[model samples]
Target: MSAPAYSRPAPESNQGVLLARRLLPPVLREWVERLGGELATVCGYQLGLCDDRGKPTGGVGGKLLRPAFTLLCGAATGARPADVVPAGAAIELLHNASLIHDDIMDGDRERRHRPTVWARFGEATAILAGDALIALGFEVLAAQRHAATARSVEVLAKTLRLLARGQELDLRFESEARVSVDECLTMMTGKTGVLLGCACRLGAAHSGAPAEWAVRFERFGVHLGVAFQLADDLLGIWGDPAVTGKPVGADLLARKKSAPVAAALSAGTTGSARIAALYARPGQLTGAEVDQLTELIEEAGGRDWTIAEADRQVSAAWDLIDGLDLDGPARSSLATLTGTLLNRDH
Candidate 1:
């Protein structure tokens, strides 16, 4: 597939994304690229391919959402947005590290509209690349003489632990049945939510914001992360392949137990039973089977239930933000950013 850059919707007119852009030093972007290239080079050497020629792997990257969160949180915390660049780069690197392993675990060949690292470089190399990035993240943080408050380090470590626990739970879910909605939520929070919380907390720490403000920021990020994950689950089921960057019903084909699937199973309807039967099979799913499962979950109200839950989480996140003494161009920009997230097509 082509490696054209993926595009996101324009931020709201009132959004500070552009303002954040203005505040961001171009060096931050360059640093992220440099770090990524270093990690890739290490992977190439480890794989005995350092000198091999091939099409440049230009697009195994995402929207860098985590780093953006860190930068915005810094702005909201009264820090010069440029000051958090290292932390922002670290957050983005951490995310890509996780994604590298995730694609291997899911046996996926494509991500961000390009061949996944594992697909292009082999599984062992990809796994090592992910490990290298994780180590490099800590190295970056340690080397950031200008930032790196003790609290930021603490939050980052805690987030990393949570992410590990979440991934463990996700792997466990594949083999275990009877996953409750609560369990799934807890898993999502740990796996996806904590890192976002860490991103915001790191930003707040960078600015020397009051401890209470960091707490509130953490809460905001946690809730937003949950909502984002839920929306992602919904997309996995109902989204168009062209936009979602995957085959339609890819989740069903993998027999992955996402929120909607778990909700449908809990509904205990006949359709749910039919869907369960389809999932019980242990091999490649036919197109007919994929459609059948999607329909079964939608018919069982899983689709509606999951979407409602996502909206609730998103609203709760913003509600926390609303209570904060956040007003001004920065706050307006955040509001715009949140709205954009809620309505994203992919």
Candidate 2:
């Protein structure tokens, strides 16, 4: 979800990292910090950049993946990646804004292995900061010199509505003990996929891509977004805490009813029963209970099911690319980025 992880070239795939860094230049940090600081100052707050400790950490850039997609999609449509900087910046700011609010709502204290905005700054400051970023996202878009600014703004606005609706459904689902797989998928698409779709659509629109071309890119994003969230769900349970910046079995403790958890609940197996019973209780699950819940969910085919689903989604997204008029480099970069995202351990 974050492209900052690839901000610099990695040893394994320098080219991939180069591609990412090119899309998001080194100057990105300066602008991001300036905007964040300025916005907070205007509102009588002193929230620094997402990574700013007392000293400058420059921190985790928070995986600018969505904006990278915006840049790449524009390149596919014959627009230069550098030319899409405004759109990319807007998307990236909006994403971090969402992350700030999401952490508050989820009561999460950490992100990218660091303390969250609300955890460092007060809840009030975090909330206002998020609002400021959302407004800033629009301002960035409005100043975009590209011909496609109008269409991009329209899509971004619609995506915001979809994102809000998805968040609402997610909150509603948390209270319910059982949710269908379809419902979970819908929620995931709204929360994750829609924004990614916006990134792609906005980029292509800026490049003056045909409407149908933009639509195809959007669909590509839907598949990729679904896969991304599914993988994230798996990470919530089994990922190494050191790598994930989340405690192991984090979702189990929260009883989030993630796609994998939802699948396990419906498996009708004994393992499923145990998982359901654990979730039904009012108390927070203990560490041992979290381990047991995870094992049971895996036994119920939740883990394997989610892996297969993610793979399927990636394959579908790739298939959509075949229908697009992607150039050689853009197509290759897209493929490379997809593989990088899906194979990420963290």
Candidate 3:
């Protein structure tokens, strides 16, 4: 059920471009592992005697995209390649904290191919763990005394706030009949875009780049984030179950207010109305019903619309990257990464 005429490929291995790939040799892995372990401990909390879904869920952590961006920014700015280690770890911890909380709010059971922390540990514990991770992420960076500590702190704080607001907007959208395009863009910026921007900014901070390049790098990340989200939304609708690790039509099944679904609904096409009718019904929908909904979404042109949007953002990201005043392999690495993220299958 992949998007027709648009075969999104699996993201290539990071071996060539990512700071982690370059730095995670055995010795470096030890430090990353140590920092991760410490982060988990800092985030661990006893959820009282009572068990509830409010406790943390358990799963493998996220892909650490933000941290990687930060490290790459550092490399671009002339920081020693080795400096990415602590910086990446810190960024990863912060991202994981958001994921822990996000799962609880979304009541998601699965993440990274495992039960969510809230689903496994209970929501109460999960929330505590999330808070702990947030603190630990900054602590790790603070302890390292990286030259960019102050700048990193500022960026991290802003990123957290933006993430929270993004989640809030997502929740708010659940009850609305329609979200204006501007509002939709704003919500995405908060939910998915800003953190990536922060990652790039943190990296550049470490590199001691001029303020102007940091801004440009951040913009590049923002464009990348928007394109990444659009690709993800497209996948949620039409991706292969084997590749996406979720059932077909899972977003429709969950009644998620994703961009494609939203677009289809706004178009008010016949197929779109039929899908809405099916969605409005109570209890779990049958397999046939889910398929019907998928067809309707496609017929309404939601899939193609989102794909075009993804391409647009990718173009914008490339433009931003091209404008950056960067040097050598570091510049080339970021470009490769941008292309990789733009074309991922999952």
Instruction: State which candidate has the highest lDDT.
Output: 2
RMSD of 3: 5.3
* Residue-by-residue lDDT tens digits, candidate 3, 1-346: 3353323553345532344544433322333234344333334322111113223433223444566676667777787656656666666667778888998898888765556778877788788778776776677677778766877778778888999999999999887766655677788888888888877776776676777777877777787788788877876777677767778877888877687777777787787777677767779988888787878877887777777788888788768767666767767666666666655432
**Model 1 misplaced stretches (Cα beyond 4 Å):** 1-60, 146-148, 344-346
**Candidates ranked by lDDT, best first?**
2, 1, 3
* RMSD in Å for all candidates: 5.4, 4.9, 5.3
Report the Cα lDDT for candidate 3.
Answer: 0.68
Residue 190 deviation, candidate 3, in Å?
A: 1.3
The C-alpha local distance difference test score for the whole of candidate 2 amounts to 0.74
* RMSD (CA, angstroms), candidate 1: 5.4
Please give, for residues 171-246, the per-residue lDDT of candidate 2 as tens digits. Answer: 8998898998889999999999999888877777778778788888888888899998997888788766766666
Q: Which residues of candidate 3, in runs, are more than 4 Å off?
A: 1-12, 16-18, 21-61, 344-346
TM-score of each: 0.82, 0.85, 0.83
